[model samples]
Target: MITADKFLIPARELGFNFFTGTPCSYLKPFINYVIDTDGFDFVDSVNEGDAIAIAAGATVGGKRAVVMFQNSGLGNAVNPITSLTYTFNIPVMIITTLRGEPGGPADEPQHELMGQITTAMLETMRLKWAFFPQTEEEVAPALKAADEYMKKHNQPFVFVMRKDDIAEYKLQKKPAASKKDFSITHTDHFELDYKARTTRTPVLEVLQKSVALSAAVIATTGKTGREFYEVGDQKNQLYMVGSMGCALAFGLGLAMVKPKLKVIVLDGDGALLMRTGSMATAGAYKPKNLVHILIDNEAHDSTGGQGTVTGGVSFGTIAAGFGYDKIYSTDRLEKFSEIVEEVKKNDVVTFVHMKTQKGSPEKLGRPKVTPAEVSVRFAEFVQSK
Candidate 1:
């Protein structure tokens, strides 16, 4: 079996230090090595798809990232891999463990089908992949090949890892910091219809104005992103095009890496509800520069304005419960603007849940800049200082 250092030393030498993934038994040793190593940053993702999106964001932030998971969880990863990474031409190193090898191991019945189809599924997804490194001689070449392919295509390259490929690597310390004594509060009370509250336009306008040039803004998918673009696209703004519900995770990744740059996420109620677990993930990491803003329009404004059941939800209470250092929930535009301005200067991990109306401008336009261009521009701005 190859020792963990066999692959990790070379991978790190090639500037692949940012790591995020869901845990799997087959990947335990490698994950332990990554966590214990001094130069690596690993995020325990809530799911495989979120892991991919986080890695994509790290890539855009000028870091080479690796996302590792069990092959079975590849099903969870397919959406962002196709829609987010593929569509945007973002490159991330992918490492998926072989849970059910077709002929080698008679393991659980659940893993059998996944084992057989894992490589085939990757092929169908049009992602170029190679087997995980199993020898000292193979390490540099494997990473080299992945680096070349990713640099050329600007897409993900997979390393299908098999069981017993990596030898045991013991962790010397806890993977996380000492748990902070924090609590979450749940409060939900809204009494307003779409016609009574402020529309998304002004809410976005205030947000666009609140962001300083040193800060980075990430807008969630759907009308929220389109509306933010319509309001005003800036070098500091990144509009997520296809990775639905990934804005918060992306912001978290950016804030964690670029600690000096304030990273704010402009999230929609529908989109936030889609991946609420990401909030818990962000709270767990507790990046001081991260700010999460959720505008509750109570509808899928991008796709025909279907109503969502957010009026009954207490997002601030949820954020506080999720260990956010500060929470703000408001229905008034004045209160919303105040909170936005406050977070721009504050260093605490904060969440602002603002209740807003459903409608946007009559002629909402998509960002003229393409997703790839947005990623590059945002990356450049983040690293500028």
Candidate 2:
């Protein structure tokens, strides 16, 4: 067996310094090693799928990220792995432990079937994976192969670790950013009819003008991104074509790695409500550079104007409860722009909720650029500074 450092040190040297995962017993040593190391970030995620989305965000922000989990939970990660990461051409490293090796050991019944089909499942997903390195000499070559494949394909690579592959390493101290003692603080409520308020189009317009040229704007799927693309397209803007509710987490991941850049997430009510858990994840990380903008038209405007429950929902209060340091909500366009300028200068994670009317331009067009092309240009822009 090899020490966890045997592979991780090299990975870190190669700039894979961000890590997130849902833990497994076999991952104890490796996960502990990553947490104990300085300059490496390890966020214990709520689930495997969200972990992948977070890594995708970090990858988009020009930082290589690694995610670790149990092989059995790979099923939980399929959606984002296929839709979000694959669709956007984001590359990340996945280290999953094999719990029930076929015919090698008698283990828990739950892990047996998963182990039998793990390798095959990965192949089906078109993920090229290698057995996790077992010795000091094997680590370098394994990592090199992963690095080359990820760089070439701009997609995820995997290392399937087996039982006892890593020698035990005890965590020396409580990690500096270890889970904290926390509580949610709700925002003050305000009743307003967005019918008399601004619509989605001008909100995009104001955002296009307020942020710096170097700032990155990640708009959620559906009409929100379409409207932004219609307003203006730039290298700094990434119009998320799929993975509907992942925009905020994606923006959070980017903000975490590239803290100097202003990263704004334009999320819609339907999308935000779909993945409400992501708000907690974003709030937990609390990246000062991230500005989460939720525009509530109280409907899924892209899908025949179906109404959402956001009319009675106060997202600013919910975001505050999730731990955003600053919260702003507006029914007026001028007030929204003022909050944008104010939050741009505030060194804290902030949330802006805008009440808008349900409507778009008569001819709002989809982004002309393909998904891969958008990803490449966005990556280049993120790395330029």
Candidate 3:
């Protein structure tokens, strides 16, 4: 078999230096190697989908990122893979371990069905994939093919790795000490007038004018993005369409890779609830450039205005528990504008939970710019010095 460095060194030479993924036994060596290596950055994501989103963010920030996870968790990654990467035409390399090889090994009962259909699943997702390189001689050609395809199509390429592809390598780096001391500041200015509170349009207007042109804004799916697009579209703004809960994670990834760029995530209550684990990830990494702004209308405005469970949920406290450096809660548009302006001046992982009325502007329309076009321009804006 080949050493982990055999493939990784070449991958690094080709600009694949940023890595993020969940653990798989088959991928342990690769992950360990990356963790121990001096030039690589590895983020252990909470789930497979978050891993893909994080890697996509890094890719958008002009870094060649690689995501690795077990095939069992590939199901978890399907949402972002299809909606985020495929729709946006953002290319990131994915290495998924084949845990349940049908005829090759007598495996656990859980892996049987997934092992049989792993390759088929990849094909169904319209993801071009190949069996991972098995020999030293195969590594170069395999990476070349994947790299060429990704560069040409601007879509993700997968490598389904079987067990024993790489020689075992133990991780040498020490785990980071747990963060025991941290503070969260909550500024509550809610008047508790749900109907009288400001709607999304005015909030979007304030954000449009408040956010600096140098900062990158990522709006979560649904009315938030639509309203923001309606307010005004800019080169620095990315209107997320289908990846409902990934805005924060994507912003975190971009913030990590592009430390100089301020990454703002305009999140919705429903979408934020869908992947609250991302907050914990953000808390752990604590990217100083991330600004998470949650407009909690307490209803899913895009989906027929269904009421969500966030009415009683205190997201500022949640952000505090999740380790955000700064937290602000408010219902007034003026206070929110102040918070935005305040956070823009400082480099801190900040969260603003704004309570707004649950409604949309009349006949709100979607963005005319396609997701692919937005991604291209957003990436260019991110890469600009």
- Number of clashing pairs per prediction, in order: 3, 0, 0
List lDDT for all candidates, in order. Answer: 0.87, 0.87, 0.92
Best by TM-score: 3
lDDT of 3 by residue, 38-151 (tens): 889999999999999999999999999999999999999999999999999999999999988988767888999999999999999999999999999999999999999999
TM-score of each: 0.95, 0.92, 0.97
Q: How much does candidate 3 score in TM-score?
A: 0.97
- Looking at model 2, which ten-residue stretch has the lowest summed lDDT? 185-194
lDDT of 2 by residue, 117-209 (tens): 999989999998999988899988899999999999889999999998999999887645654675666654345565677789998899889
Per-residue C-alpha lDDT of model 1 across residues 1-385, encoded as one tens digit per residue: 7998788878889999999999998899989999888999889999999899888878888889999999889998998898889978889999999887977766788999999999999999999999998888888888899999999999999999888999877777764466577554566545566578898889888877766575789988888889888887788988888778888988887788888888889899888888899999888889999999998888998889899998678888888778898888877887788888788888889998888988878878888999888877888898785
The root-mean-square deviation over C-alpha atoms between each candidate and the true structure, in angstroms, is 1.8, 2.4, 1.4
Return the lDDT, model 1, position 34. 90
Runs in model 2 with CA error above 4 Å? 175-191, 212-214
Q: What is the Cα root-mean-square deviation between model 2 and the actual structure?
A: 2.4
Q: What lDDT is reached at residue 125 by model 3?
A: 97
